[model samples]
Target: MLNIQNTKLFWASCLALLVTSLSFGIRAGIMNQLGIDFQLSTSQLGTITAAAFWGFPLAIVVGGFVVDMIGMKRLLVMAFIFHLAGIVLTIFAQGYWSLFLSTLLIGIANGTVEAACNPLVAALYPENKTTRLNHFHLWFPGGIVIGTLLVTLFVQLGLGWKVQVAMMIIPTLIYGYLFSKLDFPVTERVSSGYSSSDMYKAVLSPLFIFMFICMFGTAITELFTGQWIGLLLKNVTDNAILLLTLTTGIMVIGRGFAEPVVHRLAPQGVLLLSAIFAAAGLYMLSTFTGNSIFFAAIIFGIGVCYFWPTMIGFVAENVPKSGALGLNLMGGAGMFAVSIYTMFMGNFYDNLIVKHLPAGASLSVYLKAPENSASAQALANAKNLAGPEILQATLIIPIILIVAFGGLVIYLRSRKKSRSVAL
Candidate 1:
């Protein structure tokens, strides 16, 4: 233990994680709400659902540069302003464009928070960087647990999703105020005398590239499953909301336990095993159609629990020279993965399977028309074709990527040991 007394720093980092996680939580909770409220077609739904992810890459880049140029304090403030503004915009969003734009703004804030806090936590506890990082990430899924339950309650109480979204502002405001009083450490690019060239070199290394591949798979696995779980569950189970809550709740619990688990297994071993389970889980989720489908989700969640944070934590442990640049690069690369996966998968899913209604059918007809209309027939056909089986099978992309990343990591480690022996 590094005699850690900076409770403020730790909690502030957790709050940042919580804020980012809740964005996904609220978005998942309200995704269906948006479709119903806006009478969106499946294509429109896919685009809007992926809009938040589209902002992530830019947010990561801009936030990192801003933190380097200005400071984490200023970046945090900017992120909070953007987050608050986006949340408000989303609550009152009238149509597709507004929802897309608002989510992009929120994505910026989410990415900024990650860019700032990840490096901050690593600096606060240099010796226990990975452990602290994993612990900090616990709040993310933890926040999702809270958000899921809260939104479920609100819906049951007849408050609607808008009110549920507005509740996030309370935490945003509180965290913003608390962050104001804390001392933000200078980013590595500033304190360590790393020039732009050095940072670029750090980013271009084989190690960095391998980690980036892991980041891509982790981001795809985390977001696609959580975001689309509701859709997947609905295809197999009657109570989609309850099943979603259970799956998310289990995910949170698994993340909570990951710190201790990673400590024992080591990051590499854990990641290797995680890939195996993740592949099997995705295969199960895809091939199985019964209530047993959720069992696969559980396994998938457990396997991926340590994947994302451990990717960042690996850099913190191994790449000290990269400094804040390392942490920012991790966040940037990870969210960039999110942006690409969301855009690619969502669009492909929509155009390939979701678009087009039956003859004489439109968005309005799907929303308010009788059950026997052509719109209903078209929607049913679309839903049936694009069912849980197909959606879960799509997860094979991440599972395959995970195996490749594992092989890459293995090759890198072997090469490093061989070089050391020659030296």
Candidate 2:
């Protein structure tokens, strides 16, 4: 029988995760507006956006270390405060720095949600860690779908970006209220009698370290692409935000029905296959244009649907001794990698525009031109030419994941065989 209290806590965690993903979707939708309104370069925009990723790692790592001592409720309270503050600050942001700091705060809240809730769900359903984790994480994409649709609708209605951003406070408050009223269980690591030293030692194990490194590739493959979908694919489609909606919509379905897939393929097998599809999908996106990008988006969505949760679940199940710290560490590393990559991608994208432009032509000059002028058209042509190249460059990350995950599959199988033979 299900414990009602545990189920409620689980759903509350889902709601909290929804707020995190809403921030992502809303931010992706508003990237261009922020750039234009601030008269900022792509690199500056990227830096502001990347602040969230940077702050994510810091909060999750610290929350992980202290969660056991400080308790999940307190951490969630901190998340609530940060979320409310960040959203309000973002709504009233005047310049790049304000936006950066506000986004950083939201990122911290996002990380804290994962820190408390990953272990919360794991502890709630100790018997079904991977499937439940996948179910819980389904809300990430699920919330993105909600957020993106809101942005689409708001855009249609001529609503400002700030209004879309303000909408996040609704779910944020709901989740905050739910968490405050409920009681949290002890983490699985604590209940299972593992010491802090055991967790520390386990996280440093060879296998854990290997997976930790692999998280970087998987995360960038999924997140960097999703977050920048609007900008990267803008020239390809009239409404690029819809592509984010489409991809995340597919993810919601994939993750919602993750159990049978998880059972059939195992996490390692699923990851290996995901890497293959993600690489192929990215390649197709670079090569294809117009409506064909939809097909490619479908492929890309399926490829990344299971990545974040499965990665966390694998650690939780296989490296149980590593506990919350290990889980948060994996998540933190992924976000940190994304932060660095976002900055690089912004500069690389700017350079690519220069490469495609006429000799000695300045992009800034084009930017300052009238909307209907020849310079504006030149800028458009340059962006169209440069956009696909960004996707092509990202293709390498998933290609690397294919090999890494393939090796992991073989290694795990061999170990399973060795243990069975010995037994």
Candidate 3:
């Protein structure tokens, strides 16, 4: 029984998530720096980005099974340790291989945060699970807002990017201190006598299976697009930080207002509308730029804003039998999309650049790009064409989601009507 008002615990969890979101913000800001420092191609940076996702599924899938037994505190402790170590490692990273390993560790820490906190919040406010999840997730974009501002601040101060990354350590330490002694309720899964085998059966059920599939598209649409925003806008804008901040600011407000939205649209209705927004937004982004860019971003941000939380909320409400494992599986499936697509998109962007190069131009010559000259202009041209092409390719994901979510809404509405008629 969560009889006590553990407001501290809730805030501690949010702080931890803020660290995760801040890490994402910092990374988005520094991606171009990393590319220049390492002299990496778009695809190679994709591999580095992909590294951050490698451990996500590993931790999340397993964390679901163990979170009940080991407790959220211990998992959070693990996250803190990895978070600290990963930051230190990232600060010291020199090349692709080093960055890859460090990001992989940080990815594990990020996954651990989700694995621990999702169930913690769900357990904390069982009466308002979905609403609280939406509220809790507000920090993801909020942290981005903070991070974007911080990035802008740090750049204005003429500080190195390392200082920006090191700044995350302050919150990381604060959250660790906050969670050091707070008591946690064992998940509903354990309290209700649900077994691991039962969890397996629940998650494997047809309804959950459909959700697992939807998670891939939804995660790809939101995260893949969000993470790559700076890179995708390389040619369109000299500074994308404002655009990134504005888009996420819209998301934070959207999530903040989720309670009313949920009452009005229900989760499925919101998702259906969100899919339409994401599809249209990405499609427009693929083809538009300059004056039209901000409008497209608003459309897409609104589409993706509700996706992660609503999907988590849907499963928690509708698939109670699967318990924390259900949330874990869904979360893991989403990360899995990042792991695969980051690499694929990287390679896709790289090939686009290569294919766009002048006829009879040696690929090796561009690979060893000349710092300043016609060679530089030619390379810029390749990237300009490649960036938008990559966005165009991602449209297929939301297009598929539209049909899937559309079917689910119809089926759920029918189910609701049947129950009402019976009553």
Candidate that would win on TM-score: 2
lDDT of each: 0.72, 0.93, 0.87
Which run of 10 residues does model 3 get worst, by summed lDDT? 1-10
* 1-423: candidate 2 lDDT, tens digit per residue: 349999899999999999999999999998988888877888888898899999899999999999999999999999999999999999999999999999999999999999999999999988889999999999999888888899889989999999999999999999999999998888888999999999999999999999999999999999999999899878778978998899999899999999999999999999999999999999988889879999999999999999999999999989999998999999999999999999999999988888888899887777667888888788878888888899999999999999999999999999999999999
Each prediction's TM-score versus the true structure: 0.89, 0.99, 0.96
RMSD in angstroms between candidate 3 and the native structure over all alpha carbons:
1.6
TM-score of 2: 0.99
- So what's the TM-score on candidate 1? 0.89
Model with the higher lDDT, candidate 2 or 3: 2
The parts of candidate 2 lying over 4 Å away from their true place are: none
Clashing pairs in 1: none
lDDT of 3 by residue, 94-187 (tens): 8988888888888899899999999988888877888889999999988988887898898899987889989989999999988887888889
Q: What lDDT would candidate 1 get against the real structure? A: 0.72
TM-score: the better of candidates 1 and 3? 3
In model 1, the worst 10-residue window by lDDT is: 352-361
Error of 2 at 293 (Å): 0.8
lDDT of 1 by residue, 311-404 (tens): 8888777666666767777777766666666666665655444354454444455665566777666665666556554456566766676677
Task: Report the backbone clash tally of model 1.
Answer: 0
